[model samples]
Target: MDTQQNTALTRALAEIPGPLPARGVIHIAIPHTDRFTVVGNHLAQHPDLSCTAVGIAVRIQSLPQGVEVGIKALAARCREGEKRIAAALRELEAFGYLQRVRDRLPSGRTITRTVFCNQPTALLRPRQTASPRRPAVAATHQAPGPAPGPGPAEELTAAPAPAPDPAPDPAPTPPSPSPSPSPSPEPDMPEPPPVPPPPSFVTPLPPLFVPLVPPPTAPKPPPPPLPRPAEPTPELDRAATALLSDLRHHAPQFTLSEADIRHLAPGVAAWLERAAHPDAIRRTLTTDLPHPLRRPALLLKHRLTALLPPPLPGVHDLAAPARPRVTVTPFQTCDGCDRVFRSPTPGHCRDCREHRAHRAHRGDDTRTAAA
Candidate 1:
């Protein structure tokens, strides 16, 4: 087998954000097990979760610890669709293999975090009646950041309570200097070099070009979908009718509406266009079909689509046409020594011509007997 080149895997590995210098790698023992022995075998007992979900769960659990990742990224890594990833995540969470928490930061940004907890589900837990085993899993919680303003002790002494009422000032109060408090420091700061104005003669060009014509102020509504092929073309309609006729002949009990036949016609017409025999398609639809078909027309459509034949040899390649059979040519045999020759008059072959020459030579040599 050719070596597997995981370009997607390599790209994902390259995309993993590196750890900060302040943080070092920490190893936490992750529960690892054969899916067939544990997950697949057990999940198989319940049909709803299907065998596929087990593999998807395993892919999610395979990510490294402490990597902040997104569902899209996980979907890409697992080569699964987003919906499938989401469903698998839900399934794992339901089974106790995952936990999700949503948190809001002080800045009002909300973030969702996922933890892969491989703890066994209650159904998978071993049952022992004797004595309860000490719970292996301990609840984990993050230490809360120091609560906002001040400690209870500091609140008493932090600041004296503001005066209950202040007399109205007659004049507009001067702006407080407390916020800046560093006018002297400003004097010590270095100044920027002044830019000289453009030479007086130079006229500035009109502000570049007028602000690019802002895209049409209003958005254009999406174009309506192309009208569906005018409900099947004439050829398709004809093919559909022909199919119904054939079905009626084979199984007089079968009945189908024009719409149903038209719906299936596209596939049947496609088969004919590809040079599939109409009789074969008809037989497929009408013959020893399964006993309890829910929708025969739809089933026949699927079969036609799936069983499309490979292109015929001359369907393409018109330059070189095929012959049904080899052409025959007439030939005659020599009377002297029955050998076939293309020249009918000189029937004898080249060898027979040489034999005649030898016979003439033999007669010439018998001088006394016949000369």
Candidate 2:
């Protein structure tokens, strides 16, 4: 019944499908005449090995003899990184597909030799024993040569046959002895009672009581002070380097190598960044000459770092506050009211002036009315 059902299912699948969804890899193998390697199915379809490991194994098998199959070499050839390649190699080694043996050569140089196995299971098979050889008489017998004369057949028949009549003698059997009676079974003894487990001797301690107050923690050492933000650009560095190199021309004691100039360029660059003049830097670096001047670089580094001028202050920081201007007018007494007031020149105060103008207007009005 199961076979019938399977047949019906197969027919249905065949009739309804254009092409079934690809469930797994479909291989299109072309036989190779030239550069093909024979890889065992055990390694190609290994259940324990990952895809990467299987690929690496296949590649190693196909490579020509003496070609490097180390992790670095494989990594360089393949797109996978060194770490993944190494991992795949480890997997191959674990599954018996690869083995690395460290051998010391006669020249005392140690090298790692890798062995790739196609059929891993073959490594586990035991060696077969050799078959026994035939007896000496049979081994010595040779085939008959060509007939020597007309009576060759009669001569062959007359030749003595190789002796083979020895037979081995059988050993004599010993006479049968009378059987002894079986010993009686011993009486059963009572089993011992089970022993009680030993009691634990350790005493239980009371729970520890912690204080409510938190213990004082040591203050974190102040975060390391930040390095000065030295803005060393390409231009600044180049200028600084030139200045350092020229120091030897000005002072023979300050002769520095190319390495020293490169190392100390950044330090001198920091001084230039702080609005320090190039002349000032040259003077500072070359002014004081130690008699011996064991290390000119060290001296320059110390001066550059220690005596780096602070950045020039901004306008606000440098400029003093200006006092407001005040004009001092001369003090005057009003002519009409005699009230003291401040004025550019002696004159009546505002109240007195208004009163005099009022009086003059009133007099003008009376004179016009009379006319």
Candidate 3:
């Protein structure tokens, strides 16, 4: 495959987000092609194969290329018994979905590695037998090539004499007499009437089709346009890529994609447009990160978003809410009514406030009652 097509296919396959590092996207993702699907489907639906076997084959196919998945590992991953996994592996191998190769390590240790070809191919498998050889051509004996010259004649040539013939005839004998004819039988009393022909059968009408339930049909939508992978500006690409690379260096286990970088490019671009130093942005993103982060891209994105500067000050719109002004004020608590109020005059609350008129009225009322 050409570079562009292969890259696009890889990205599409990688879209299936994997479990561990990614959806089996290590440094590169395995291309999911028809061949892979065919092998998986064969194992899944073949009557002789059990569901456990199908599940094992499918999970192995799901793994990325270069993954070291052994029978034990597979059993653990699939939650199947080790023996079951071994049997499934054998079945897969027998069915051509798997192949085992013995590779000798540098230390001379030979270990068997599996190669899986999921295509439904009819391979010309060879056998140990002698090849039938071609038949030997029959030898042709040429009749003695025409005698040199006609030769060899007899001594005398005498004319042969003819012989005469003689014969005679005889008389005939009388024929024997014929027997007399027998009497004829009497005719039947009355002849029977001829039988009428049967009536012709009419053609039958075809049966009208009636279904138990209406066939379900869904409205089909117009075909969606083929995906055109976005091409980001070179500078944005470099910045985003560099950030992801640095993060990887900090945390090796972290998995990130070019798509993720492109997705976060706008935020990075926003920071860049606001005259934020690229170094400052990088420093802010990489700073104070947890040791083992589940998703580094998410954390980086959040930091970049927080670091983004707001648009420069502009003339306020009339419809927009105005910004409130701020002024410092002292708070004091009223002695009579233990209520705190912010103001210049704050002896007490107005209702429980200290006033001269109410005190005199209270004293006169008390004195009148006493007299």
Candidate 4:
């Protein structure tokens, strides 16, 4: 990573508070991977807490809770031995990088579980500098020089004072009013009539009521149609054919059974014809056979003899005497039936018999249903 990326990562890690130590030991341990080494080297170069490089790495990596690893594993990938690794780890511990927890394995091995040091360290700032103080100089005793300018009392008395104002005179006043008016004469235009007050009563009208009408009902939505079963696509059929063909080529045993070959008669016949014409089947089968089975062709020829119905009229048995019986010891027991059986058996004999019986029972049920 570049310097900027490293610096950013370091800053981010520093921002994450480390874990508090429990029982005086850090429990979080960061593996000594390349990432951890890079972080450690960066911490050594920066103004970071001394002991926290590994702890920060662990936290940044988001290691699982309670995960612990061996110091031997940590030191194995380092140039330094156990001592130096321990010292570096201790420095980190002291710096509050990780909280170490002591753990004992079932194998009687002791290990430390170091957790991320999430607890923050006290950050100290630089102190301010004090200003220098000036020393007070002593004045020489000056003689009572010729009387100084003014006396202190004279200076106070020289200030100005204020004046006072005069008073004014009063004046005179006046009188009051009388009582009722005398009657006057009436004019020829005389007595225009007085108007009457307007009427206060109003007529009450009957309320006109209209009946409420209900809104028209909306049509019900059609029920969602049932989902149709999916039909197989041509692509799917082609893909299945290709997959089966590949399986026949690579894992022929699965497809070479008599029942399977009968269902795939045409294909099997073509394949066998090709095999026989070019001798490819024989060569391939011989190469794939296990070492024990690959003896001289004569052994196969002898085995095939029993497969034939009978020998030609004049053809005599030109085979040598049979080899002595090889006593094969049984090594395994059938897990299903708990019966001891030979190693070369295809499967557990009793279990196989039971399985065959179960299959036959199922077949019988199927036949009955058909009937």
Identify the candidate with maximal lDDT: 2
Candidate 2 at 337: error in angstroms?
99
What local lDDT does model 3 show for residue 124?
Answer: 31
The better candidate by TM-score, 3 or 4, is 3
lDDT by residue for model 2 (24-106), tens: 75343446898777887788777767788888988998898899999889988998899888878877766667778889999
Which residue ranges in model 4 land beyond 4 Å of their true spot? 1-67, 102-112, 122-371
What TM-score does each of the candidates earn? 0.27, 0.30, 0.23, 0.17
| Distance from true location, Cα of 256 in model 2, Å | 66
1-371: candidate 4 lDDT, tens digit per residue = 44456676565556556744456743334458553323344444545333334443444335455544345755665455776565555555555454466799999999866555333232222334444444444444444478777888988987765664564653554544554566543333434344444443444433221112211222466643312113434543343234334434553443343343333333223333222321342343334434454333333233223222222333255666689999987677776677777776645676677898999999999999999
Give the candidate number with the greatest TM-score. 2
TM-score of 3: 0.23
Q: After superposition, how far is residue 92 of candidate 3 from its true place, in Å?
A: 1.4
Candidate 1, 237-307: lDDT as tens digits:
58756876568667764577777766666667666666667788777767777778777766666566566
Candidates, ranked, lDDT: 2, 3, 1, 4
lDDT of 4: 0.46
Every candidate's lDDT = 0.62, 0.76, 0.63, 0.46
The per-residue C-alpha lDDT of model 1 at residue 371 equals 50
lDDT of 3: 0.63
How many pairs of residues collide in each model?
Answer: 0, 0, 2, 21
Candidate 2 CA-lDDT value? 0.76
